[model samples]
Target: MADKVMVDNQAIKKRRSFREWKEDTARRLDIWSRKKPARRKFWLNKTLYLMMIPYLALFFLFTVLPVLMSFFLSFTYFNLLEAPKFIGWSNYLTLLLDDPIFIIAVQNTLIIAIITGPLGYLISFILAWLINELPDKLRAFVTLIFYAPSISGGAITIWSLIFSSDIYGYANAFLIKWGFIREPILWLQTEKYILPIVIIVQLWMSLGVNFLTLIAGLKGVDRSQYEAAAVDGVKNRWQELWYITLPNMRPQLLFSAVLQISSSLGVGAVTTTLAGFPSINYAGHTIVNHLQDYGGQRFEMGYASAIATILFVSAIVLNKLIRKIIGKVGS
Candidate 1:
C-alpha cells in the first residue's frame, strides 16, 4: 500500500507540471497576437518613411533653417563686418517710431496689396469661368492668350516705351491728338502717376499660376452634379454656381488665394523695375524695397532680419485670415 501511494503522488505532481506549461504557452501566444499587428504596421510604413527623408532633409536645410536663423538674428545688431550685438526690441521700436520711410513703405505695400490682390483674383476667376464655357480648342487658345503676358519675361520694357516721357511717345502723341493734355506725362518719374502705372502693370502680370489652377478646377468639376441639380429644379446657372460649383472648387480657391496674397504683398521686383529703386519720394517703395535697402545696401544685417521677420509674420497672419474667410465660401 505504501508503494501504491508513492506512484499516485508522482502522477499528481506530473499533472500539475503539465497544467502550468499549458497556461504559460497560452499567455505567450496571447501576447504575440496582440503585438503582431503593430510589428507589421511598422514594417509597412518603413518604406514610406525612408522615401520622405530626402524631402524633409532638403526642406529643413533650405527653408526651415534659414527662417530660424533670420528670426534669431532679428534680436541683434549685426553689421556684415562685425559680430551681432544683442539689442532687445530696439530695431522694432526704431522702425515704428523714428522711421518715416518705413511707414511710407507699409502704406504703399498695403495699398497695392488691397487693390491688386482681390481685383486680380476676381478677374482671373471670371476669365477662367468664361473660357470654360467655350469649345475645348477655343478655350485652350484663349487661356494661352491671357496667360502669355505673365510668362513673357521682360515684356514690361515695352510699356516703358509706351509711357515714355518723350513728346513722341505713344501715350503722349495719342493724348495730344485727343487734346487731353498739353505735354508728355512722366508716368514713372512723377509721384502722382507712379502708383497708377505700377498697379496697371501688376494687374497685367497677375493672371498667372492661379488662373491655370482655376481653369483646371473648373474642368475637374463633375457634370453629373449639374445634371442632377437640373433634375432637382435648380433654377439657373447662378443658383447652381452658388450651391454646387463653389463648394466643389473650395480647395482650388484656397490655393489661388494663398498664391495671390503672397504675390501681391511681395511686389518688389516689378515695382523696382518699373519705377526706379527709390522711386520718386519712395512713392512706389514697398516693404521689400526697404528690406533690400538695409540688407543689401547698408549691410545692417540685424535690422534687415527684423524687417524680414515682420513681413513673414504679416504674411502668415494674412494667410490665416484669408483661409478663414475662404472657409465660409461653400458653407
Candidate 2:
C-alpha cells in the first residue's frame, strides 16, 4: 500500500514537471515570435538595400503591379476597345452560375492539378534522389535527357508524330499491330483521349529546373550524416530517406512542390499544342486555356483578368498548404 502511494506521488510530480516545461517552452516561443529585428542588424545590412533596388523595381512592375491590376480589373467589364466599366460581382457570378465552359475549365484544371502536381513532384524527387550520386558525365547526360523536353519549345512536333491520329503514326501503328484495337485512336482530337494524352506529355516534360535543383540539394547533404545514420542502425533505404534525406532536403522539396503546383495549375501548353486551344467538346480545356481565350483571342480583358486573379489565388493557397506539409518533414 505504501509503495503504491509512493508511485502515485512520483507520477504526479512528473506530470507537474512536464506541464512546467511546456509552459516555459510556450513562453519562449511567444517571445521569439514577437521579437523585432534589432536596428543595429538593419544598419549592418544597409548594402543589401541598394542590391535589392533593381530586383524590387522589376518585381513591382512585372509581378506585383500586374497581380494588383488583375484583381482590380476582375470587378470591371472591359474589352480591348472600350473603357472598363465596374460590373461589381457580375464576372465572378457568371463564372459560378452561367458559364458551363468555365465550370468545365475549373474541373479540368483541378483534375490536371490533382493528377500532375503530386505525381510530377514525387517523380522528380525520386529521379533526383536516384541520380544524385551517379558518375558526373553520366549524371549530366541523364539530366539533359530529362530536362530537354521542357526547354524545347518545338517538342510538340515530336509528340505530334508519336500521337498522330493516322494509322501511319507510331502509337497507332503499334497498337494496330498488337491487336489492341482495329481502328486508329484519335488521340489528340477526341475529347476523351485529349486529356489523357496531355497528362502523359506533361508528365514526360515535367522534370525541368525542379529536377536539377533537387539533384543539387541532394549533393549538398553531408556524407558524414549518412554514415552517422548508418551507425545509428538506419540501414533501410526508406528509413534513411525518412530519418535523414527528407529532413536535409526540405527546402528543395518545398521549392519543387511550388514549381509542380504552379506548372500543373498553369498547364495549357501541352493541351493547346496537342488538342488546340478550344479543344474538341472542351474536354481538355483548363483555366489557363480559358484565360488565354478571353485575354488573347476574344480581348475580354476584364473577364480574363478575373481568370488570372483566380489562378493566382489558387496557386498561392496551394503553395501555402505545401509549405505547411513540407514544414513537418524530418521533424
Candidate 3:
C-alpha cells in the first residue's frame, strides 16, 4: 500500500509539473505575441496600409485569382457555360502531335520575336537618344508621331489600310508606286510572307512606345554619371551609350524586352485582324489564336487551358533565362 501510494504521488507530481510548464509556456507566448509587434509600429503606418487595401483587393481579384483559376483549369475541361471535367496529359499530347497549326504558330511567333526583339530595342534607344538631343518642343512632336500607333495597337481601321488584302492596299499601292512589285501581293495569305508582314507591322506599331519607355529610363539616369564618364575620356556617342547609357537603362530595357517578347509570342490580334480567323492557310495562327480556336470557338476548354498553361510555363522559363543573361551582361 505504501509503495503504491508513493508511486501514485510521484505520478501526480509529474502531471502537476507538466501542467505548470505548459501554463508558463502559454503565458510566455502570449506576452511575446503582444510584445513582438508593437501597436505603434502597426498603427503608425495605418494610412499607408489603408491606401494599399484597394490595390491589394484588385490584385487578388484580377491577377491572383485568374492565375490560380487558369492553373486549375489546365487540368480540367471547362467550357465557360458548363462544369469542368478532369483530363490528363491528352490535351498536351494532342497539341504536340495532332495539331498541325500549333507548329506553324510556334514558328511564326519565334521568327517575329527573333527579328523584332533586338531591332526594336535598338531603334527605341536611338530614337530616345535623338529625342533627348533635340529641342523639347520638337522632341514632344516627334514623340507624339511615334506614339500614335501604340494608342491604336488594336485598331482594325489602321491595320486594314496597311494590310488590305486588296489591289489598292496602302502598302501594295506604295510598293507598286515605287516599282517594287508587279502585283498586289497576297501578303498574309502565304506562309513565306505572313511572318515578315507581321514583323513589319509590329515594328511600325512598336516605335513611339518603346522610345518613350527608353526616354523615361534616360531621363532617370543621373547627369553626373555621364559627366564623370566624359571627364574620364569617354570619347564618342557609341562609347557613352555603351558605358553609361546602356548600363543605367538596364532595368527599363529588361522590362521593355519582357513586355515585347510576351506580346510578340502571343501575336494573335494582328494576324486575326489582317488575315481573318484560322489565318490564311493557318499561316498566321499564333498560340493565342490556337487557344481561341479551341477554347473560344470549339469550346474545347481543357485543351485550351493546357495550351495557356504551356505558354505560361514557356514565358516564365524564357523570362528567367533572359533575366539571367541581362544580369550577366549588366554586371
- Sort by lDDT, top down from the best: 1, 2, 3
Kindly give the number of clashing pairs for every candidate: 0, 0, 0
Candidate 3: stretches off by over 4 Å: 1-34, 37-48, 154-156, 174-182
Which parts of model 2 have CA positions greater than 4 angstroms off? 1-42
Query: For model 2, what is the alpha-carbon lDDT of residue 160?
Result: 81
Model 3 lDDT per residue over 221-303, tens place? 88898899899999998888888888888888888778766766776777787777877778777889888998889988788
Cα RMSD, each candidate: 12.0, 18.5, 11.9
Worst 10 residues of 1 by lDDT: 38-47
Residue 292, model 3: lDDT of 92
lDDT of 2 by residue, 1-331 (tens): 9999999999999999999999998677556655566654554565798799999999999999988888889999999688899999898888779999999999999988898888888889899988876899999998888888877789977888899999988999999999998999988888788888888888888888789889999988999998999999998888989999999988888888888888999998888888887899999999999999999999888899888888888899989998999999877
The TM-score that candidate 2 achieves is 0.85
Tell me which of candidates 2 and 3 scores higher on TM-score.
Answer: 2
The TM-scores of all predictions, comma-separated, are 0.85, 0.85, 0.82
TM-score of 1: 0.85
Question: How do the residues 1-331 of candidate 1 rate in per-residue lDDT, one tens digit apiece?
Answer: 9999999998998898899889988676656556789755655576798999999999999999998988888889999788889998998888879999999999999999999999999999889888999999999999999998887788777777777888877888899889999988888899988888889988988899999999999999999999999999999988888888888999999999999998998888777888888899999999999999999989998899988888888989999999999889857
